[model samples]
Target: MLPDPIHILKTVYGYDAFRGRQAEIVRHVMAGNNAFVLMPTGGGKSLCYQIPALARPGMGLVVSPLIALMADQVAALRQAGVRAAALNSDLPGEERRALWRDIRGGTLDLLYVAPETLLKPDVVDRLATVPLSLIAIDEAHCLSQWGHDFRPSYRQLDALVARFPDTPRMALTATADTPTRAEILAHLNIAESDAFIADFDRPNIRYAIQEKDNPRAQLKRFLMDHEGESGIVYCLSKRRTEETAAWLCAQGYDALAYHGGMDKAAREANQARFQHGEAIIMVATIAFGMGIDKPDVRFVAHIDLPGSIEAYYQETGRAGRDGLPADALMLYGMEDIALRTRFIEESEAPDQRKRMERQKLDSLLGLTETAGCRRQALLSYFGDRCQPCGNCDTCAEPPHLFDGTIAAQKALSCIYRTGERFGQAYVVDVLVGAEDERIASFGHDRLSTYGIGKEHDKRTWRAILRQLIALRLVDVDLSGHGGLSIAEDGRDFLRDKATLMLRVPAAPRPARGKLAHRQASTALPEADRDLFQALREKRMEIARLQNVPPYVIFHDRTLIELAAARPASRADMAAVAGVGEAKLTRYGPAFLAVIAEHGKGLRA
Candidate 1:
């Protein structure tokens, strides 16, 4: 019989117990069964498959999407003494030959391959000769066309099911809505009964959404809370990424830009730098963070809107992967929504797909405009519910609501009276009776709804209009120009004189000076702070020497534990969390020496 999984977990991985459904999924896979896993990012999804792969008889084959992701996982596994390797186009001839030798020699435990490389005829034929333990598809949502990050190559993976009929298979992803989940299950030939769905809440990430008002200023303020920390600032466009990165550098931040538009070498080098260095801010587009494995991202800020909630969740989920306190701050405005809608309407996707995209956009807009707990609204999108989490902006400072019936009527009537041909700026201008030449030339200056909305300022009127659009009381024209028209519901709302409650725009919250920074460092006592820093320096030094990311050797959490516990001997260090046998043997003595020196210094 195979060794006990718990024994493998403690001895090989150094975790005391499995988290959530990890143990159950491992057992199911180990029993030669297929499974689908939907867990949040940083929810120990890797262990669910890694443990089974170790305990099973043959080498496990993992299908990953990105080379960086595969390389990082392989590095971490090797550091833990697992014979893991990856096959990708980036591998040199000698390395590729050696990896195949290991695979044929039955010396590899887990092998991660890209879908494209694995699907090649020669690779498949070669793999067919080897005894396989299990097949795992990470980032499995890419198989679903409905998913935000769909890849056509993922659809071709069904061939694996037919080719490896007896080997157990599992599909895993961190962000998949209901439809995406069903698509993955259907495409992978996994039974519904075998799926494990965990709660889609990341309670550790404090969610904050603000209406875009001087976005650069807002982003800078958010960054103040995360000073000297590693974070990602996502922009909507490649140009914006470069500009933001440059601006951040001007402000004395160690910032770098990464996007598809950059040269390949530069992009890879920037990613490598961000991965290996601490306190570096990476300003990037959506192209940057699909399968990143960094564990200590303290914040994820989006200066522009993401495509959907799944995209938003996946991007923000990158932060605090080590389960520490982190922040997800997003800033959006009317232009962002219009741009997203225009992209959807102009896309070549089928009508059904377009409708689904519109619905997803609507859901995301609702999240942005929600006056309730952001977490509750976010979870509700995934068919999960939670109590009003005190961790979000609304829960911390609830927005004030006002009777928006009159304001809505005036805004909708202005759009209707103007023949619904104008965009938001013209409508707002007409409402506030601006002395603009276009208003007079269009004869909208004399309309009954012209100056009637003067009770609210231009900013307030814009907010009202946005809330109307979010509520489906108004429709944005998809004709490349952002014209506003009253929806059927808006007509009824106007006719029936319905009451509407809209949020009064709240001022941006001030930076919680050193609060976030303190939370990250507070695990160590005042006396242990120096030791923690020293340990971190040592980790960085060793990581640089090996040319690998620091976390591959040990995570910040493990370092914090060492500083607090000050493990005196090899046995004591081995007992610490994240210190498995391989890591203890390789890294324990070095860490213990640091602790010993720190102790001597204290005595002195």
Candidate 2:
């Protein structure tokens, strides 16, 4: 009959409302029902489980795979004054024992552990005896073999869950398609749990794909455009991460490199520096993103194409976590595609796995080349509909397009004439009528296809060649491997069996200034942003006391909008977006109380 923990959220967390399905998800779990949350990067996924853990009578068991993530989450929760502890191998044995004792004594609200630890025979036996209100899996996608960041250890989770079937369980991830989602359910044997799918659209990120010529120069230009803004640069190799980080530092930016190859001490040091805002850029391999909770990353760049769209989404999702404008830039070429294929071809994974990988790669390529709205394509892949976001490069500056049917025929004929042994540069030479020594050595000057397309400039021919490759009309011979070969589509074009329409590369636009100032100008004043955060902290406390997600009382953006507008009365508050009748009736007094208190102090 009591109002439950919703009042706690209003008083403690300073939130007057819930955003999206957070309240629904929280209730299902709090009532001892199982849940599976599919929220995007900045979708407030943590609170779906964290709030119930605090409000519930017993400690919440959180199974996290990474020590760094666990440490970060535990630190953040403690900072918010929640009683939390993590038991991991990184801690001293004595500390671990003490944590277990504390959990047993009901002194902790939440406890985080690695899945490996959860499966230990002794640990499982001990955990089974604890007063656990719920079991939560943080990165649940890792449990699926179909997932990009798959871990075999996560299979152990099923056994742990089997031991505590009566306890409520929730699995959460930022990226998972239908297949991976099903895999998580079946693997954990929780197929019937209530599923909450947050829309996958990242509205603030502008997606850009540039040809990777002079890649370092292109990267430098990108860094210059976003100087002093926070971002992550993902590299395919450790050496590249270090080199790029060093180069960024040389360019007078705060940059550091992180890879699994680094010593634990060094990696932690770099990660800590990045977390605390001491470094503006982190050049890292894939290991860097999993539990990264930094909310202000302005951009994410891939010097090469990632292996899958899911991986690409998860990586790029790390950017613009504050729901602000960010960029997702990829510099890709034929080599990146080949590299990814080689990985799939050489891996010991089963055929199904290989096929899945290929499908994901193809989806990523589709993203790079699609002429329609990029965000729409990305969201549609995850089963969400969206109008053009009007934010990405394709939306802001749509590419110029040309009919490339004739160009395709000419290029395909050149490749066939060259015996499919020549790469783009050599082919470009023949098309541009360049009778260089390399062309002379190959006798390409004598070919019927040579000099036929000399009417176009070298740059024009190069653009046509790049577009052809992007459209998959021409295949690069993986053996000789850099050389050009007509793909099935190109052969069809040569035989008049198919027609190709290719996009004309748009003229490059000058880089704009960082959007940080514009962002700050639109939000709270520099001085009041901290105060706004304090007020939200108070709102979160209120929400927690009431046993609801913070947003159920007041969304963070609404609070920020209020802070910017500085509304004093219910009428003023009602005018703000997302603050409706119910929220006004319930939360107007508490929010006004904080505003009045802050105003009084300022006037004094």
Candidate 3:
């Protein structure tokens, strides 16, 4: 029903093929069927609409939320020789009018606008006259109530579908769980549209959650390990962002800070430095996550725990967008939980919204406390199954757990000896056989078990204390200024009737570069080696233009296989392992063209 899109691959977009279901979605959009795309953060969601916009007869309307993102996407599309323009609040009146004229003149392939602009009756009236082919909604998750970053203006998006009932529509977002997905479809009035859900697992990233104590030192060590690699350090406060960024800079790393507290101009400048790769580290708050298009982020570290798993996932998803190995680390403490809870409780949200926020908070706490595989716990929370990522901190240095029956008794005795009202420092002081003035004043020096654990070092004893708290053997008095008290379980341990396994912390290892690509095969013929690199570069360029991860455009494994087989036709392309009808139809010809070009060069 549509013209062959083969030329799009070579002439305009410069890609040899479509990855995953992109071509199918393109065809579906061109045929005027509504679509809902549930791709990951770095997946090629743009090509679905971009290719169709070029192939179809009329201009495609893309509705996006962020001004910076829309501007960046429009610039990239123009570089690829596609006619695109964005209309938003930031555009001057003359510039906006000119863009509208371009759209009406049939010169623009795609038009991007903010949802607020689309809500104006006058704007909708103008759009009604254009020969619109398709409507694309970016960040569709913002429409869902279950989503962490829900925007009220997004509720008006469904009206666009109503205005042009005959126009095909597609909605896409990176981080949406099943509930959020359902909400997106319901809100958009497209529950029955064809849905494309890509794989949620980002196997290239390793997940880590460490107990918070001296978090700044831990962060420094993490940065030192991954030095020179691009990373983001997330902090809960603006002050912390500035301080951390300054500290990293002092330590001889290229670092910058970004937060809402900074002036608009300064924030923009910092963001530019980061995007251009001039700054390898960005210490920021939640404001930095949504519109960042960087793909080579090697690590995402949380200096403080996020309030929820959704926030954590969305923030960490920024890393490894290139489908390369990345790391996600979280440092947590009792103060973090208290801070998060107080912040939530003081919010002005409705009761229902408050309840939802609490549920999300509980999920994050579970993530921090879980002793199981970090990746499994994370994916399971999002309603997916995943095995332990063998490269994570837990798998790399599996915790050394020892029977804590005796140690638990000693810890409980110390807490009891201190009248169960003192903090950890005092308890540790009493346990380590210290007879300082503070201990002597409270008669803790006279307790029978005061010197029982003196043989172990302070660090070892501290780990035991953490284990006690983690296992609920010791109750942290949340309302009592964080004092330590014996729990019911601690009483049982002291009676010598309970068994415990206390983990001894290991020395942190220097950060090492990720292992070489084990996902690719070594069996490629020597003749095709040059072709392989060419194909990968092409993939990378396409990824850069579309603002997606390289693997989502076309996986490295798929590219390697294509080089080996040298698929020379549509049918040949369809035979590749990951290639399907969507990809073959969208990218087959472009791929054939690349091989043809390379073949001629070799012959010459």
Candidate 4:
């Protein structure tokens, strides 16, 4: 068993050892047992099943959610010299027929198909006649009703358990809380004990949340460090994605816009360019995320707050897939919260689901305002714990805590005095003693609570209100119109004269001018830095010619290792972590030439 998995890992995938629970998972799956894998984005979830498919005697069926994902994975596996192919609508009729023939003939070790395709009875019946090894359901969280990436097609996969009762089955996902995990277990008929939840912390990712003051400027400054790197900028709306992408490009960055609203050709073209080219920034909606397998996305930025912590975690997980240092930044404000709240309120989902969504949103806000470690707070939400990572925004510049009991009382009283039917703007105007027509029309300028908050500017009051909303002391009532109303706790607090503590949002800091700043001297020596860049150039050229992502050729980490070690011969090159026999033979001489030139430089 060790020989099989190790052989597959080193010879096929080019990794010398399994990182986490991957070895255990491969062994369990190969033994023909049911499995439920909850691993991180770059945690090698695919290897758990891919290895078994090779060591096992029958064809492995992978139930994937998207055609693009299937095609991409298939292309990647094929490049590694594996017998893999995807049967999806993207294939022509003849191709599909021929793929089925290959499946029937047992020529393909791995067969990737979408859930809808696999659910067809004829397809199931056809598979029953073939030599079946094991079945894997990728992105299994899509089956959960409460999951952010829910797909009705994944729920239909329950039928596969009954159809392939004798065969081993696996359901894998990267994003699921306790409830969603239970649902996936029940829906997929996997036992509770068989489930594997690997650690959720992507330590290589440094998290930051800015207050969104001058968000465009903040984003521009943030991108200064990550210039000449691949990344994704997530926005709340399609219009924002397009606008941000256009603005970034105009500012001299290569950027692309991707959203569901875009035509297929446009989305595909952008995705391809981002995948194949270096130094590309993709501004996309949540729709552009799930299937992206790029490993060197150095940063991920959110122009707006996401709908849930789950969505935020999943989106940010897209960065630093290769375990290299990366960054995650979000620019959020009170409006982002209010708009996210409105979306949850307007959702046709059941009241219970809406309540859960609101709770999730509040959790995200709590992280933004946390006075402690951001990574610790985020992991705690998922039921994991660790010491302060000292790598996130909060850990860097701790939020200043202020006793806001007086401010809270003032804001809540204003909400109550204003009839709880007005928006925050109106409430703010009344509080700040702005004699506007709306306030005068309502005669609220005469209220006792009016001008009580004049001691604090409108921005200060808004910050207090934002904290109140986050604390559930004030809840946005969306029954008739979007209005600010005191929560049950707000009334209790006022009646009991409770003290409130709030965090002062960090002020926007001036950019360190990282692009102008030299690269960190620690990644490689100054002398080898030039050699590393040459290696990257060669990697990009190979990727473009081969029509694959650059990382597929060699991850940046591997290149860093190559530059540091300057492997002198083919054997030494194979000793590098990512260099397996297939890649070593195909491209070893080319890389060796580059290294030899560096050796010449050193000799000179």
The top-ranked prediction according to lDDT is: 1
Ranked by lDDT, top first: 1, 4, 2, 3
CA-only RMSD, every prediction:
1.6, 5.9, 6.3, 2.3
What would the per-residue lDDT of candidate 3 be over residues 383-469, giving only the tens digit for each residue?
788777776667665666777778878888778767778877778788889868988887778889788898777777877786677
Candidate 1 TM-score over all chains jointly: 0.97
Worst 10 residues of 3 by lDDT: 513-522
Q: Tell me the deviation in Å of residue 223 in model 1.
A: 0.3
Q: Could you tell me the lDDT of residue 555 within candidate 4?
A: 82
What TM-score would each prediction reach against the true structure?
Answer: 0.97, 0.86, 0.78, 0.95
For candidate 2, give the lDDT of residue 199: 78
Per-residue lDDT for 109-208 in model 2, tens only? Answer: 8899999887889988987888887899999999988888999898678886679988888999999988999988876667554888887888778887
The CA lDDT of each predicted structure is: 0.91, 0.78, 0.76, 0.86
| TM-score of candidate 2 on Cα atoms, chains taken together | 0.86
Kindly list the per-residue Cα lDDT of model 1 for residues 74-146, writing each as its tens digit: 9999999999999999999999999899999999999999999999999999999999999999999999999
Model 3, global lDDT = 0.76
What is the C-alpha lDDT profile of model 4 across 315-362, one tens digit per residue?
999998888878888988777887888888888999999888878887
Candidate 3 Cα outliers beyond 4 Å, as residue runs? 5-7, 225-228, 350-355, 369-372, 404-424, 430-480, 484-502, 513-604
Per-prediction count of colliding residue pairs? Answer: 0, 40, 1, 0
> Residue 16 of candidate 2: its Cα lDDT?
67
